[model samples]
Target: MDMRAPEQKYDPYRNYTRQQWSKLRDDMPMALNADEIAALRSMHDRLDLREVEEIYLPLSRLLSMYVGAHQRLYIAQRKFLHIEDRKMPYIIGVAGSVAVGKSTTARVLQALLARWSPKPKVDLVTTDGFLFPNAVLERNGIMQKKGFPESYDLPLLLQFLSDIKAGRTNVRAPVYSHLTYDIVPDRFVEIDQPDILIVEGVNVLQAGRLPRDGKAVPVVSDFFDFSVYIDADEPVLREWYVKRFLALRDTAFHDPRSYFNRYALLSDEEATATALAIWERTNLANLEDNILPTRPRATLILKKGADHVIENVALRRL
Candidate 1:
């Protein structure tokens, strides 16, 4: 006697398949070439013009629309309040698991957005720089938890984001070196009010526990005007990570200054095992506990197929 249909769950996003999403490109120019894309891609990532045309062009076009709208709203607010303030850079946060090609996506967007008709100044920043220095991690006895939220200087990062959002000029962020696998001492990169800033990292979208006292503690995503989360299956992520680790043995690991120089001595079998162990211990744990949980918080989700091509896009409903 019950004729009611099953209860439907609410979904916040408007999902689009590959063909559907690509149609959103809507004549966005091909601003990057094959050679340019190659240079933009990370060593272990695959990104070609087709991917840019099919996936990234649509994304860049969508962001352009959002940027234009925000600019107009800023002007309208100033007029109504009868006060003048310098425009702040639109901050975009890109988050994903390691080896899922988040860097390539960020870089590609930077390239395309810079080519906007007026050529807005765009800067790319990675949260890797805000990670705790190795010595501090060692002192804190959390070296093994290096990529976890606890391993970051959350207060320092928040301060930096605050300055950027307040239209502060010449904001300094610490420099991190992959070769040394640590934060570079006394070195910093100054961000000078770019028209837009792209902050990319594995943990940019992380949200820590809230206070019960009703005090506000802003997380990293608070600074973002729009955010993206890159996603792939867990097994695929592990496979890509292992492959990249194996490939690095012939590359970065061969450098005497490389922190992973010792890995060059590992045979294929040994390196694979080592990569698997690291994935199980650090990266996988961080992804599951911290990163993946924040996926729903993104403005858009770029889901990838096993071959690393973006197969679907989910844009949050307004």
Candidate 2:
């Protein structure tokens, strides 16, 4: 296979303006019912189903086409290389800064892809499952850098993807707990081969830090058929982070097992200050050093406005 960069021009900050994307809103296909949409909308401080339709529907369709292309490539490779009886899963990687809406993008894409009658069993997985337990991070004195690429079990993650790409079935991924902010020991989700597999996280597009000699395989993104990077201005993302933290303090953080339980008792002023502090010291630092550098590595870039809506879509022209 000739491995070269796609011929498409890369535009880092292009997006669909609200008005343009809104035109597709009314007729968008929805995998979730109204009640589920409403519930997810309530969970997000400033997002709703309409946004999903306008911004994400087109994205879903785009991914579906890529998925089809990937399958065709697999068939061609098997015929030409004489490697019969091999079926690699079509993998998509979604990367972005923290609180930049990559999670919502992954989930929405998962649901939309499943709505395709031809491939209605799409599976969604996140790199969160590869993150080491909180206790391990604390012991390694990197708890504050939890979202950094080194925070994950890279070897294990790579092996998992390797299995899937090798046409292995019944693979399992660790389960992560948002409330606890850690990997749940002994818990895992089994993934069956599907037409598509979506993996979303802060650093999915990053190259591996270790050499391939006994310590590391290739980066997980190398296995992806398509990749996306969700982007927004640094300041806007910081504000969103703080806002999300405040909102979570009122909800998820209040739960007894939440790793952020300490935030539940913070006064509004204190909570805001803490959120800003964490963003500055940790999240923002990781975004600049790790995540931002990987944006150009994506096949598509979804840029956002201050209002937290995608404003333009930049597709790498093939």
Candidate 3:
């Protein structure tokens, strides 16, 4: 099946078919092996060696070049100002709909970037850690809107990025647990000065809302040097979401401590129905309202096919 996006006149992005994108890899060596791929692949996500070689390798090569260029620019600007060139992290935002394989994309990029020459320390952080605690959500009566933009601590997230971008060392971010489906109290992840920081989330690219006085608020994407959006047909994403929900029933959902333990006893049919309802009511609405609208803001977009293969890549022209 042809999975290419329909051609549009006056489009800003320069599109490439998968085969064309694979050619850009040229002499770049593959940094990942079969075992590593298996470890990086998220539950219910398909990411084989062939997909990595054809899609991620070229993408990683491109990112490495961007990082190098940014570093040189930093030095040049510092020299012009006659100041010390204090190195700052190159922040990359990975944004996409739920079940769109964005988490796997972030992990793969982190692994690949860490292996590159000069071996800059690369760190990965998700915006999940910035979500409001369960108690706050419940108090606000927005627990049902958990993934919505309002469910996050926007000011805190903005401050975290600001501190990192200001070259602050030893920044700490809250830790979140998917098993318990809530923020872990008193637990934090320390991010030392890293060469690259990958911030992945469903709302990373979302623009902040205007205030009552019409003053502009800073957005998380404003701090991102480069951003990526993972794209797939809606039906494909829904199918993956349902499959992942079912898979978790046998895995994480079976744990008595899991927030979703109630789903563990559901029959396959019942689970599918429940998953579809949740997706339609929550995830799909979030995608349409908050995520998909940010596609044009990305530096690059990875368009996946029904089989979870990236079939096209759209890179914004400089």
Candidate 4:
């Protein structure tokens, strides 16, 4: 068996190794301290100050530049059209497979961007809130496909984004609880005219499956000023997912309020078996069928190594 990794192919993106990408920071002082990085790190996520300095700091800086450019363009366009500057928030979409650390990326960017010059208000919203309610999923018989594209309230999500793009303030989004594993009834998150909004989810970049009639519909990525896709080897992602499941079982799953409380008393072997089964049956299938296919649509791709460290960055060429 010739067990070598497949040969790399030429791509539209300009690839930069980690070392090369880090240099782009160029004496820019690190915006975040160790404590902040620690706070931003999600459960079972392997993030540290070094990774922040090398990877996220540069990314934050790049995003800041993009935001600035976008603002200037917005102003120019408004002036050309003889209209007032409504100042829509810059939208950034972060997408990746389960347990790929995209939540950490979104949190880090939100924190770092808020600290930058002009210090724009930043908001982070996950598409989990846009998921169809449990009752709806049950009725549709897709309870097992919770993270798949069809499981989301796509129209509502699109409307929210449209309002944000139109500079509407106090837009309300539904709230979802991970502990309950469902959307909380009558609970909402209000986004009040943030300067930047980061939308994170497994399917943020996914395009809707086209119908036979060739009618066009706006997808989530259509609202993004910039998009990032976290990339990793499938085996590494599977390992991380399993590890996260185990960690949650020891912590959140023990709470009586948790939907997964039933798994809290499972033996380690049983827990591992359960986690593996869930991942293989749902998450892996979602990744292969939906998430991975949208990778090319991102403006930036942060490619992670087996160690959960971002080893390279591929930036889409202008």
Which residue segments of model 2 deviate by more than 4 Å?
A: 1-33, 39-42, 209-217
- Across 1-318, the per-residue lDDT of candidate 2 in tens digits comes to 546577555445354566765564454467777565555443443456667777777677676667777778878888898877867778889999998888777776777777787655678899999998988999999998998988999989998998888778889999999988889989999988766788989999997566656764578888898998989999999999988999999999989999899899899999999999999999999999999998888998888889877888777767
Q: Is candidate 2 or candidate 3 better by TM-score?
A: 3
Residues 4-31, candidate 1, lDDT per residue (tens digit)? 6655556799999989999999999898
Cand. 2 TM to true fold: 0.87
lDDT (10s digit) by residue, model 3, range 1-318: 556667634677999999999999877898889999999999888899999899888988998889889989999999999998468899999999999999999999998889898788999999999999999999999988888899999989998998888888899999999999999999999898888999999999987667899777799999999999999989999999999999999889999999999999999999999999999999999999889999999999999999989999999999
Clashes of each: 0, 7, 0, 0
Q: What's model 1's TM-score? A: 0.97
lDDT of each: 0.93, 0.82, 0.93, 0.92
lDDT value, residue 120 of candidate 3: 82
Candidate 1: misplaced stretches above 4 Å?
Answer: 1-7
Compare the candidates by TM-score and give the number of the best one.
1
